[model samples]
Target chain A: MNKVITINLGGNAYQLEEGGYDALRSYLDAAGRRLEGNPDRDEIIADIERAIADKVRGVLGANKTVVLAREVAAIIAEMGPVEDTADADTAAGTPESTPAAAPGTAGAKIPPRRLYKIREGAMVSGVCNGLAAYFRVDVTLVRLVFAFVTFFYGTGLLVYIILAIVIPSAETTEEKAAAQGTPAATAQEFIRRARAGYYEGMRTFGDRKAHREWRRRFKDEMRDWSRDFRQEMHQHANRWWQQGGPTWTPRSGAWFALPFLSLFLGLIAILGLWVGYTLITSGTVIGLPLPASMPVWVAILFLIVVIQAIRWPFKAMRRSYYCGGYGPPCCGPLGFLWHLCVWAAVIWFIYWLTQGGHSATLHDLAQHLPGKLHHALSSLKQWWEQL
Target chain B: MSVNEKFSSLRKGLLEFLVLKVIAGDKVYAADILQELSGTEFATQEGTLYPLLSKLRREELVDYEWKESEAGPPRKYYRLTAKGREQLQETLDYWQKINATLKNLGLKSRP
Candidate 1:
């Protein structure tokens, strides 16, 4: 007689005879632990079982009728560990936690469950907040615990790794509750292979009534997981507006900060230059050329000084304008292109209105740079491109 | 007996089979399971029993239905699945091989 193994897939039962119960259980346990914390944990676990099922029908090469432990172990070993962090981060950061609630019905709490706003900064449905509710602690405390662990003994890192393997990423509040269970200790290479989804996966296998409840909740959670990526972005953007910088540009938009600073300094410098140059050139009969008739290099230096004075404030406060992984200040190559188009349009509009054009002096700026300065500018441009 | 000796005598792999075997006949309750295992070589530990029983229930070898108890509010009654009965037969066959070897070595009697 051969003992058969049955695994739950989407509330459906799948049976395998060759590998038997132990083989199936071990595969589920190992694969489940590996996929602990990922957002799509359920899907990954389901896929792993599907993969196992696909390979489970055949007997060993010898006279064996049932699948052996070694074959099951080999299959799991071949699957490798489930990786939580993936290419999804570049586009979505993480899959959105469960489906959305009705617009007017936001912030309603689920019964027998704690709920709170998650880290709108980087999270799947304020994962931290929901966790805080379950732990009966402050959200900051939960975050701090994770942060401290991640920082010190890599406890947080291991937890994250296990979570990526075991804990499903929170999409809806219901799923977040599930991730809080199970204090993951080890990879337990053997036990996992012994117990599939039906055994150790449940909170307590004593009763089946709660499972029926979990199944119903799980359907809602799946709906939550299948939401639009753009809506998630909108939710994130909404989060920003609620607690972040105001959208309206201030009257003193630094719009005139640089221009004013430059004007003030430039006027002072011009006045000083006029008075000093006039004094030196007018009074002194000779002394290496007149002050007012200073060298072209001196004029070039003055222009450089004016540009720096104007640009300094903008450069200093540039960090304040960072738009969350947005490329760079509006002066990079792309920004330059955008500015060119906008400027051309504005110029054309002005040309249409006034029908006139004027030109400034040939700013032979780049030509006047010292060799070292030229190298610095080139490096800066390269750094901008890398960004 | 030392706790480990007591646990070993009761645990001995066959206990899982016995639990499944006993439950296979009827949808028995938790107290009923405790009473049945008591009559056999298997001695159930308080701390470990509930969790292990739960694990067994999850494996689908045992299925349970809730019945309101006269003494308490409600209690869960468990029974074996057809799959569980098949599993019990398989375990018994595996046990027979080991049990026969033990008896031949004069290290065991009828269990």
Candidate 2:
């Protein structure tokens, strides 16, 4: 007794023998490949399927509900090989033939190449094997290159992991054929690839099961750890609040802002010292378009004031946070009025520096500064020569 | 190429023109068109016919309407458009001209 498989074709259900199903599936796959790049590929395939359904229905009886392999083979033969239909399409001067048949029939034995990760004969995630296939190189050579690069900071391993995630594995026979640059356009090639896939699946079955079990265990451990950590944090926060540890008071808000203000001032002082050193060494400022008349300390002070103006709202936000996160109303209108005045002053200063008569003075400094530096360097060279 | 290959290619080229002629006759289902060509040298399978019909439709030379069928689901009944008739007339005229030229050449070469 042969095993039967049920399939839906053209919205009708039919039972097919296992062998018959395989043959039909491969035949349809070949047809689909043959019609690749055609605009109406799906519609034509649907029509072909409906025709196959009609033919199969004609052969079925009340008692003989299951389609046998020989009947399927006969039907495929009547429908003709996909190659013949492609030939007819090309001969008929259909525009689609240029793209679909160009690689297959234009004296090129290879199909259009696409990069796909191969699962068969893969050592680790199949990335190297896929790369070797794509570039038509030996797998050992590709692996050796990856190994050599991995010694330099392990970037090669990182790249391999990324590629494993990015490139799709060739799971189906058709995809495998496409990956190898030889699309299976005949039943023999399809069956060969399908058998190879079956063997690969069998070989990897045990490893796959172990990997799945390990992943499940890891996920369970992670979930339990996170739950415990969250509970501990919750209990600690509750105890601290219950002890009345300075919650949501103006004094506490001042205490929080003090540290940030000191840190900001320290950072600005370090930056100012660095800019002063660069200016002395280079005899000119690097990025800043400051006029030579303007003092470095004046520029630094202006920067500090501008940054403080921007940080005003953030300071208010910290105060609100100490007030139990109730937002701006907790701080009241005085803080908002102070922020508006600071922002208006900062904007007017920036506009004066960029657009007011100061810009022309800055431009004159930019043009003359380079020439002045050149003259000084020449005079220093003359003095060294005399010595 | 071999003689058989050349002849088959020529027949394939003419297949589309013949399909246009068939659709011009009446609004017909795909199976009906297949049946009409079954006995002729241009006989083709549904696998070949469907794509060809689709191309013809895409070119705006033919169109189809869904019609209910008794045996199964609704079928697409195909008919030629106005442009298809104009194209068919030009093709026919070109064919006659070629035929006349071939006949004249044949009579002169016989001497």
Supply the TM-score for candidate 1: 0.23
**Candidate 2, lDDT over the whole model:** 0.67
| Per-residue lDDT of model 1, residues A1-387, tens digit only | 234555553333555443344434533553444345545456455544543444443333345535554565554443333333222221111111112311111112233443434332323235565567567777778766765554432345345433433434455323333333322212232334334533343334345876555456545644643343344556667776887644434344556554665566566546544443433234332233446666533543443345444544454344234332233454454554443333333333333323221111112342345765988999999999999
Please report, in order, the local distance difference test score of every candidate based on alpha carbons: 0.46, 0.67
Error of 2 at B10 (Å): 3.0
Interface RMSD of each: 19.7, 5.7
Query: What tens digits encode model 2's per-residue C-alpha lDDT throughout A258-308?
Result: 578657755754664455445433434456567878765455455545555
Taking the candidates in order, what DockQ does each have? 0.02, 0.16
> CA shift at A100, candidate 1, in angstroms?
47
Scored by TM-score, the top model is 2
My TM-score estimates for the predictions, one after another, are 0.23, 0.49
Global Cα lDDT for candidate 1: 0.46
Docking class of 1: incorrect
